[model samples]
Target: MLKNLEYLKSGNEKQRRAFKVINQLNMMEDLKIYSPILCGTIPLSIDTASSDLDIIMEVHDFSGFGDKINFLYGPFPQFKLKRKIIRSKLIVKANFIYDNFEFELFGQAQPVTQQYAYLHMVIEKYLLDTNPSWRCEIIALKERGFKTEQAFCHMLELTGDPYEALINYGLRKQII
Candidate 1:
């Protein structure tokens, strides 16, 4: 479910459940205008029980995107919406818990593929595929409180900021 997301239907239990929940809420179709893309730990198969479903979107109309998110998820458990500036871009984010899965809807004017979350997931997936033995070590690092990207950075011996380090490494290696 990293790119097209259809594979989620046949993936592991959590993945299948994620697909069902997304379909049940009509998330993809409803947010199709914004190019909603699933990007997060689950797709990388290293998700812990606490991992939330992260859906990134390309949104130029902040007002409309905020309204749509509010209308769609404001009633859900622990639903919250906010606008904030990240990386010098004002974006909208919504969070809610439903069916035992917490959902994070992140919208920005930039293309979803260019967003850090998506890029990180893609790079991590690539590393996982090419280095099978690192999976357990990465997960172990995460269990010790390192974030996903941080865990990857630690394995690579990247010393700078984990997020930036990951991107820089990926760009130099052409992984993303």
Candidate 2:
């Protein structure tokens, strides 16, 4: 059994196993996994405990297949798998055949230019300061329709400082 991030941080055996699995999974061709909570790209609230793992990948020639390919290719042979594909998103529900371990994968669409831009900005800023609070602020801004998260991420990527003016403007509005 794999431990969650909290236990992983404390160097528990389960954590080690989980990390090992993550590494192995990463090594698989055409797969990328990301967790905003785990990456500190978003606030770590209690809600993250039950969050499903999120992944993005370039499956070879998956343009038309999208979710279907994920459904067919994602599961281990022994696992009983259920899958759904909506637009570019793929959702899977499965239990490990051997251990009865339950897991899910939520696949997002291949990022568009806007999303890539947002992610780039976010990563740049995160690299500069690693401030979880700031990341949360960006997410909030995105949710509030200021811009796509990718756009914000891209802004940060380009300037390394974003939301400074916007944040101040918002603060002044609240005070007024």
Q: Once model 1 is optimally superposed onto the true structure by TM-score, how far is the C-alpha of residue 44 displaced, in angstroms?
A: 0.8
Superposed model 1: Cα runs more than 4 Å off:
none
**How accurate locally is residue 67 in candidate 2, as Cα lDDT from 0 to 100?**
52
Estimate TM-scores for all models: 0.97, 0.32
| Residue pairs clashing, model 1 | none
* Model 1: per-residue Cα lDDT over 20-131, one tens digit each: 9999999999999999899888887788878999999999999999999999999999999999999899989999999999999999999899999989988998999999
**Cα lDDT of model 2 by residue, 1-176, tens digit:** 01134444445443344445544544223333322122222112211222223223322333333454345445654544455675445543333321221233333344421122234333334433545456455545555554433344454453433444333332343521
Candidate-wise lDDT, in order: 0.92, 0.37
